[model samples]
Target chain A: MSDKKKTGADILLDTIYKNGVDKMFGLPGGAIIPIMDAVKDHPIDFILTRHEQGASHMADGYARATGKPGVILITSGPGATNTLTGIMTAQMDSVPMVIISGQQATSNLGLDTFQEADISGMSYPIVKHSYLITDPKEIPKAINEAFFIASTGRPGPVILDIPKDVANAVIDEDYDDTIDLPGYLAKPELDIDKIKDAAQMISQAQKPIFLVGHGAIISGADKILKTIVEDMNIPITNSLLGKGCFPEEHPLNLGMPGMHGTAYANMALCECDLVVSIGSRWDDRIAASPKEFCAQAKKIHIDIDLVEINKVVKVDIGLVGDAKDVLEKLHKYLEPNDTSKWIKTVNKFRKDYPLKYKKEGKLRAQHVIEEMYNLAGSDVIYTTDVGQHQMWAAQFIKINSPRNWISSGGAGTMGFGFPSAIGAQMACPDRKVVTIVGDGSFQMTLSELSTAVVNKLPIKILLLNNRYLGMVRQWQNLFYENRLTGVDLEGNPDFLKLASAYGAKGFRIRRSSDVRKVLKEALQYNAGPCLIDAVVEQHDNVFPMVPSGANLDKMILGFPQKRKELE
Target chain B: MNNNIEKHSISLYVNNKPGVLIRTSLVFARRGYNIDSLVVSNDSNNPKFSRMNIEATGDTDTLHLMLAQLNRLVDVIHARDLSGEDILQKELSLVKLECPIEKRTELLQIAEAFSAKTIDLTENTITFQIAGSSEKLNRAETLLHGYKIKEIVRTGKVLMTRGEEATA
Candidate 1:
């Protein structure tokens, strides 16, 4: 074998290549001049986004679209801070991304230097891990480790702050140093005793229900979740965050049990004797009143994040490990059984209050969602930007697999879907990644299309053009006497034209009949990112919305027949 | 070899901060359980929330704890147990050893066989890196004693784990 000597930047770019990262989303800077110069001659394409935030969002979208960690590069201070929202969005949703920021020279680090901010400190809470490379020798290790940490279990972002001096410094040390990080070992094995105990409770319970969450997708445990649910014949209800964990059409699947969830789904949860929560933090929106959320049920909470165990509602059995792993183990302990009564009751409620949309309109948001869901199929990885579109996707999209739906669950960041889909696409290149963004949220990271074009990632973007911030407008309609505040954007770009300018395929779906045709064409392209501007009705809203502080039992049904009057 | 396990206690002085304890516990948690009575506190002498005293069982745990503790920011100031009469226990080590390609497969087999993970390897050259208590390093050195040793660097032990009622 021939020996070849390479510079730090060369090694770094080679490392990215080895990791199968074909593109990078970032803006050039002074500190990262060496890397910029190196990248010019490298195999990886550098996407120059309009802003650092846009670049980060594109990286985020790529990561969401694929399972690979999205890579974003930026300069110090303002450039670094600009990616904060995108970083926070990925962090909240647990999307894998690597944010590489150029830092001031090591010699000027603590001297209150120019273009320097405590970046590692600033991103500490939000990132999976962080590194400030002051030595050129550490660059290879840092980059390798950042990728490892970001793409691994319970995926999230990792930021590497590369100082100017370090980037320019020449290190004589060999490039193949295998980094040993003894301090950060998070391989949690399945605790057998806890599993046995949980199995016993689940086996004996009359009304056992699986409350699936984002952890199910993160842990890659959808198969295990489905097997257990099917074997035990237990009804499964997902949190809004857990929408795609199970196929919505599954016999026992109760779609999205939360604030705006079906009345029967909420009732089933309320009445169930056993609630096995997998990979889900008991967020208030899902469990409106934790004390009363599932007072009738004994919970078996399994999650990878230890901090989330017994956080709000205390669980009878708290097995802390990756949900996917734990579920794989738990499947063995369960005996084939039946829960027909529970299934019948849930089905009855499901039939009575089935998800409905008012027809006889010019265009309905639900129609777009159904068409999109059908066009992409269950195998597609879907991401949604916050607003009415997100809720509509939750209701309409029948996600049959894990890691299928990436959204801003906790923070509800609007501009999140577009960028996170970019991140997802980069991570899982084999599957089609489609991001559903509203007219308002799409504008937030709309500049990221340039990155998509540069990288040549085929991420289908479905912009649900409502021409208004639907969620805020809904809130205003319900509470503020329909007083629309700054919820309206007067002049929005023609999305088709915008996509074309970025060198992408674009389509505009105005009539209801055109939805499926346009969506099918978008998904089938398989060449590069495609944008479908879905001109949905402006006044459409996400119904079954339980007003904040209102009881989950009480929700605003879209139609009179859809509302359940519980005695 | 298991007879060498004479429940040793080595307190590691470290920085008290969020995720610090987890960081310290992770090293031992990776290999197997190492720590016995791990205690942490703000040093009275340095009231800026500085020290941590980690006591571990088994010589391997003590050595591994010592090396792992040194990497932490708070532990940067000083880390050691207070043993009487200056036994001169310096806890710094860097080894750049070579195992012949002919014997390389066997030597590396011995290295990895003995938990000596490789750091870097070239066609004719290979680097083995390990950080732990001096005794563990000495044992590691003995295990690879037959290999051609190229270079060895050591950082002196600052102090030893304190005894009953000792401050971190």
Candidate 2:
């Protein structure tokens, strides 16, 4: 509203502020100095992370925890390149984010000048959209469009690379709010005929199962999903990313179904006559092998992105639209049906073959996770790094609401938990945020502990230190005849001292009996940030696991039995 | 899985922006499809938009998915598989052949048979330009194979519907 001319950076920040982005996560450098200077006058909070990768993941975590597009700003070249993994993680998981990278001056582009990079070109394949702004007049328009495109229609990350000179250049104060993207379509109209057909299919099926994915949570379709499940009396299973979409304690919930899925969930998937998938891609982990997944069942897939419809497993009815809208329309035509017999059969399987481990033994990672769940209750936001600990957390953590369970599911990126927990805590200051990370995965981005301390984020880190890359070691023990090479963590640092150096609280529990007491203290600690290093049994393996390339029903429950016995 | 790779003609209507072409082409590259020919220009009716015609070879299922992926790009308004439609396709090519005095008469006869025009002639080389279906250009190039060919430049295929129905 000011009549004075503004720099392109100010205009860009103003546009972002207008779009409801109040927080940004990133580091500053030379090329981005102008924008950093302009931030002094803005009301937005800029969280400075130790590394650009951490910043990007924080943004992704913030977006996943809250249903808002997280923002990231960093320098060009190495700083921009460092965010590729985080950006790809968001892209794979469909987390909404806007990455603003500072590039060299426009005149020096393609000349390989200092800190110059073709960031827009390099990120084109991974990003939903990318822009390289040369003219200062287009700053406001580009920022607005980037935010719009990032947060709509199967949301993903978008990149905007601004040259130094462009950020420093002056522009008129008048900002146009009109978005003129002729090709960008945010929502698609649902086909009512398709919905009616899907409803008919559901009504006729003797045995039906609902396979929920992260899209259900992303579209805020929790109530719709719960209503459909209750009205239809169907058992629901979740993908790894879809863990918290349906309440875990619900009687119809069959837990997560995949490679590391529960025995009952996998059994229910194999026995179902119809699989109604909502907002979930049939990735390799979920499907095992596309040819063998749900071989006896017809599938009804509903998703926002059309590309995910027949990309993996062909469905009998593929409805491409927003899940909430499609489900609302489908609910009208669906009659209240009952599958009590089918539910009885699924419940029998769930009761007979539950997720169990030996109670009397050295500390197990699963026990620690279950203890944390009991101590923290079901209201906290939980995250995990990629490893056996992640699978344990997914299986044990009981989440009752959407956006409460945040992890890098699609990308399965290591070191995502700690920083993501920080973002989640920042988004919801009143809610408790906990990150369960493995020993190997924790070291990858542990530098973000400093960020948590600096920002006074109350994030509890449950470090399951098994003295090895537990997942790979388990694989080696099972398949490679226990030939453990390069999987051992012998030279690991004393985590307590490291936490102290970062000005954070740290605790350790070496005995199995101390898990409940120590976890209670860690969760209750009102301090800024805390790390609990629990030394678990090194050889503990996640049970009810479907080995790679195996069928969904071929699970290795407990210790490895003979192949014939498993069959 | 079906392993048969067939040629597909895909037409795309996109915003006339700087990185739109690269964004569209990256989809093909990422999917491991080789673009045999590509033609891009501003739309005649709408100056704000452009038309891109891409000729690529891939399995039918993969190409079908690629069409969906291409349509997902922010700049692309619409994308369709034009191969199965009743469409007219054309490509222009200029071939420079080393024409010695002894082979001038024979080359001229071959060019005349293909209805190619002689764009430039030099002491030892002659350039022939031809515009038509890709099949016609291929045939013309094959007929001139006996002569010493110096260079060949081709503008990939551009397509339009046969009837009054517009693709957009």
Candidate 3:
């Protein structure tokens, strides 16, 4: 770097390479020509994506799978604007990511020049931080700060807008070790007194439940969280993204809770006298209403973000710090509790209203998930799109390790599964990566299959082609008096042919009996990407459904023909 | 509850960099806080930092949350709410009135009562400059309400604690 005159582009790419990033995802355009030109000089390999949105989502999937900030590069204007959804999705889920977009030259910034945009301005609300570099010398520090800011605290996306002129400007800049960010609070100190108070409360409580979420995984507190739960003899329930924090197969696990949650977990959360939420925010989908969510529990909210403390629901003790840090101190003052009676009640709920579906009637999504889960290896990483299939996957698939379950939980974004699966597959090339996608959700970013085929990523896609936007259809069927409009996908493309056209393997699960066979073929096909289109029942809704704004106990366990009235 | 409606003063010490003002305003706007008045200028002590004095009305809980978010901004050095502390506050207001021949003397008397100075005078109009709290400016404007007040502008409130302690 000293011998060669490095331009701003070289410095930017060098800084990224110095940060330990070997590969990045993006598409090249006019605004980013300088950066693209410098790419040949650097050792970094760039994955050419069909669209910038795919680049962002792929980066997101990579970030979630590996606990590092996923890096993305793109041009300005439409290219930068296209990454907003991915940025918002990652931000909502607290995934760490960095997006570098090329801006118009500094001289032609406000004249509405070609590919000119105020990207950092547009991304202000979605990103953790943003920088619009006017000087080439600022590139090194801006990049370093971006990576640091994106990966620290409650990890989120950050944007670095480098003008084309800045990228082409020759500068004698080098990556610096010092980070000049005084305002950012990356790590908050653990309050020992608050931990003690929370432990004391847990000890005195007769009925307690451990509600864990994505934060536990982010903080790497799974082992300690399990230790705390077992020591306190509490039943544990996870949120949608909370899977893999506590093993779903564990005897004390109550599975996921909320709108499409398991009956027992929701009941346990609703009836418990004490609720210990570690890392999980009080997301709206958790229950019928925030007012009634864990209304009886003397709640203890432990998280890394301070704003999430009294954000939605109030808590008695709010410990604003990392989950692992608080749990480490909390481990010092723990003893077993006599949970004979509460366990009996939790077991009764689990036994009486277990998650059920019509196994013998038709090829339901539940059956497909069941067969796929049974067939696929237990160590597979599952990323899902937003819809009924995502919910069914959450209910059926049981993850036992952290970072194995990736989904668009908060944003509920469709078209996330395929590209994200590509990212996850690239991140963990050794592990099996599968995306449970719906027909509606899969088509949104299905163009990325070309990226997968070209890159030769061995990603398996489980496409549940139900011919409808099933989640919205269910809402319309239940809430809007069956006046379904805009939920039907009548003229959907043949996914099998589409897969073949992209030079990827394709299979179809014709019925419940064929699920295991087709999934086994897809899962075992390791040459490149494979798509398994399981055309499930058209009107089959995911059960254990808590109607929006309804209390947890008031669940519709089955369809109307087999419905059981709640007491 | 009574204190919730009253305008809360937030003082921020931020890097004198571009987009700092927009970033600070974005935090307040997201928390649904309306900025009644704001004054931002270069910090006298250090040219590298800027001082922003903002007064707004909103719920106390959201205000605290917004402050935390604002303080976390990369350019914001420090942000603090000084509404509960004992402080000296002031504002300057300029009022131009369409004065009749006889009303000029009467308007001067009203201005004198409020310790106002006649900064401008013409055959048909007079303009008064007054300095005090927002309430005093409001009273001065009300005293000349019946007359045709041509223009009125007030520098939103600014404050500093009485003790030798930093506001931000």
The candidates' DockQ values read 0.02, 0.82, 0.67
Interface RMSD of 1: 9.9
Residues A100-208, model 1: lDDT tens digits: 8988888888777777887877775567767777668877877887787787656788888888777766566566547555434455677899899998899888888
Q: After superposition, how far is residue A454 of candidate 2 from its true place, in Å?
A: 1.8
Where in model 1 is the C-alpha error above 4 Å? A1-6, A14-22, A43-45, A110-114, A174-182, A425-431, A454-459, A500-506, A513-530, A559-567, B1-168
The TM-score that candidate 1 achieves is 0.75
- Assess each prediction's global lDDT (C-alpha) against the native: 0.74, 0.90, 0.88
Q: Is model 1 an incorrect, acceptable, medium or high docking prediction?
A: incorrect
DockQ result, candidate 1:
0.02
* Displacement of the residue B122 alpha carbon in candidate 1, Å: 70
Please say which candidate is ahead in lDDT: 1 or 3. Answer: 3
Q: B-chain TM-score, every candidate?
A: 0.42, 0.95, 0.94
List, residue by residue over A314-369, the lDDT tens digit for candidate 2.
89999989988998899888876679999999999999999998767788888888
Give the least accurate 10-residue stretch of model 1 chain A, judged by summed lDDT: A558-567
lDDT of 3: 0.88
Give TM-score, chain B, model 1.
Answer: 0.42
Q: RMSD (Cα, Å) of candidate 3?
A: 2.0
Q: Tell me the tens digit of each residue's lDDT in model 2 across B1-168.
A: 567689999999999989998898888898777888888999878899999999899899899999999999989999999987778888999999999888888888888988899999988999999999899999998877877899999999989887787775
Question: Where does the lowest 10-residue lDDT sum fall in candidate 3 chain B?
Answer: B1-10
